[model samples]
Target: QWNILSDYFLCFLPEKQPVQIRENKRYESIKIVLSSSLSKVKFNFVLYLCENIFDRFLTFFQREEPLIHLLYHELNDLYRNVLLSFLKSDSVQQKSGQDLLNINFEQSALWISDKEIKIGRFDCERTRKLMSSLNFDEKKSFYQDVRKIYITIANYLKKNLLLNNMLLRDLQVLDHSSRTDQSSGDRIIRIARTIPNLLDDREIDKLENEWALYLVELVDRSWYIKDEYIDSNGNIQITHVASFLPAASQLRALRSMHRSCA
Candidate 1:
């Protein structure tokens, strides 16, 4: 019964599945071209982290802002920092000159646990021997190549994965910080322009007027509601909830109207 349901539900799956499978095969083929097993492992691990870092960041949803723009910056920072830290690490001190690259891949292998779906067990002894056999020039060249790959991957992520869409950028106006900022008028206009049916010219003018009034009220109330006080230990603490955007309720009403029409 499950198989029958899957067959019916996924009838058009063939249109997309083969292309993905072919892409995966091409990626695997490229990995096969890399001569060193350690290099292959490093490449695979970096790619795995690149693909999964967003999922890791999603776990912080309860603590972090729900804005996509914020997520893009935070996730990009986390990914780049991890890769940069790995590239810059030179903890194996005893080795002199380019022999820094001669260390065992075991250090790299230790990064992942056996529970993680990684490549099979690394032969640390054989890897160490292979690395140590390389001369200074060879080691230098290999290190440069690895560094280039990491940089290229980082650039690829910035271009493809991060949210650079105009609509997403305009949506930032809904965030608490942007909502309360004096300079968010343009962003608010952009949001209204993007979702025209949701906000006509008359409503946009109304919102602008409301926003001005809202900011005035917020300033007046800040002294009472948004307050900072010194504790007994002399540590300053802020205790205030940010005000919601006035445009939010309007958008919610628009959504309700669309749903009712549907």
Candidate 2:
């Protein structure tokens, strides 16, 4: 690139301009050529050069906020990933600097992983397959690593967690607000009516079923509930069980799990 630019300069530079004479005359050079309108030319050239450099730099450095946001959104769809790959590669590129580089492949390899797929809904066989991908590393003391690809799938999953949690939370509130003896089976049926708005019917059914089981497990395990149930109007009423660990806590646990064995 330098050679090309130097050649262009040599060809276009006026002969009346001063020539540089070096100790190695065979390898002589000219100083940057100037014009009476040099400043204007230089200003324009600098602008052009800055833009050229910026174009190159942009793929390296993040610039304007809106542009970056748009780029990320567009890139996400184009790459159909969380843009973790871009982050990882940018990280690597920053560390490797100017001129020639010589590094061993094994040493250069980025060893961290980033992939997130729900372990919750997966069946026994599919879940087993996911476990197989983890390979049970002893060094990290974590049985599985969540990120396997260059891009960590955090951005994608974060939105999903928000969406799913919102939908489920709304359903829980609506169900609890109603004062009636809803049959155990029919409670799921109420959820069935609204599945399309929340998730695909099949997925919503699966998620709701698991959520019910989770609630049951929580009620069963609670010392407050097991020890404190009272007979109200000849009915054993177990009320006000403790909530599950907050989603933030769960996400943090998963993130810790991802980084631990890595």
Candidate 3:
């Protein structure tokens, strides 16, 4: 039950598959804390905070696709901003020269829209009993431990993840929205470079040239318009579809090129 959040955390893992968070040495301290007797409270509290943070953070890059437009700088910037918000929280203050500095966590951009972040389902009888058993100082110590774990997880995401794989980043060129002005042609070549044997030199050059023509076609053909209807006059009218699809087109094109040369 406590590992539910940890399971969800795996969903955020990047393509290269870094060390698993469960066995990760960086999270050793967090694991120890979770193994403690009062783990129910600690786990639930961490879960509550993490749920909110991940939900908001995901809003930046998570998308439904045939096409997933990704940029390293975009995701990296969002990750930094999320952790910075967590760090800026008064609930988890910074100790400057042994003096605790209080800067409000509520003021953090992540929590701005949330009027109050209540641990809704986690506020059960067991949790209340555990919380009530702690004295004032004990409660303070408990919260401090929880805050440390929260910050640790945030920092881990900020630093040790595997989002920088050039292949994954280069795949962004496949997105229809990213193909503007034939710019993705060079990017397609770069992607081929990232994945050895994906395309040879001549093939890469061919793909790039084809991608340029594809761009011109996407514009001329109004590829974004998928649905056509007959007007009152019986003439066909085309309407623009919202999704930037035919992202698969790039893959299909590459495959065709590969097969042609083979």
Candidate 4:
């Protein structure tokens, strides 16, 4: 089964998520190809495994009271380990100076060098700082394991030139910025710039409502789809909210994908 699953994981790309590999000192300790970089080869491979792992975890998240909280801490531990492994890889060179996982890149000073970058709603400084410093195990706050998954997705997509720009745009507009200012014309430009990067002609033609629905499908496939409930830490209560499967950003990714097709 492991062999078969490994083979299936390899199918997403002939090799792996293909992108220009920039070596990072933080990730220097590890040497496995799939474990490093966002190569599609690694993403889909993990996606296949996470699909089953999350399925086993679904029943716990749906329960009321402390069950949901216990489940989150347990899963958060798992996410942290995955993150630790990724950080030890050579790709972690970008944020060697700080605790990369906690730095929120979009909020960084470098991103706003041009306040003239008026269109995006994201906190460029915060998002960039975070993104650059972001590592795998740092997800102590969010209850959704899928957030780690999409951050993984974002990291993998980082290699494609188109994907790189799309993500930067996301940082510029939404990563740090609140959605309350939806009235600005720059919002449309912010979104529009991302549309072209998501899908090629083929993926667009293959699906309808591709972005939103696809995320539904993606989360459902890779993780246990959760219902509305309270998120927690160990026995400690966090908050009451609907924690759906997958990183919430996946919804945006799907939307980006749909925009490309449209």
- lDDT tens per residue, model 3, 41-112: 666665656665566556644444332334453455444444444353443333221121122333444342
* Candidates sorted by TM-score, best first: 3, 1, 4, 2
Candidate 2 to truth, TM: 0.17
What is the alpha-carbon lDDT of model 2 when measured against the actual structure? 0.33
TM-score of each: 0.45, 0.17, 0.46, 0.21
Q: For model 4, how does the per-residue alpha-carbon lDDT over 86-201 read when each residue is reduced to its tens digit?
A: 23323333332123334342232323222222111132243233333435443222113333553454354233213113333333222212223443224333444456565445
Better of 1 and 4 by TM-score: 1
Deviating ranges (above 4 Å) for candidate 2: 1-28, 32-43, 49-262
lDDT against true structure, model 4: 0.35
* lDDT measured at residue 198 in model 2 versus the true structure, 0 to 100: 33
Model 1 residue 46 lDDT score: 50
The deviation in Å at residue 41 for candidate 3 is: 4.2
Candidate 2: clashing pairs of residues: 84-151, 85-151, 113-147, 114-147, 114-148, 115-147, 140-261
- List candidate 4 segments past 4 Å from native: 1-158, 161-163, 166-177, 181-185, 190-227, 230-262
Per-residue lDDT of candidate 1, residues 176-215 (tens digit): 5665676677766665566647667887787777666655
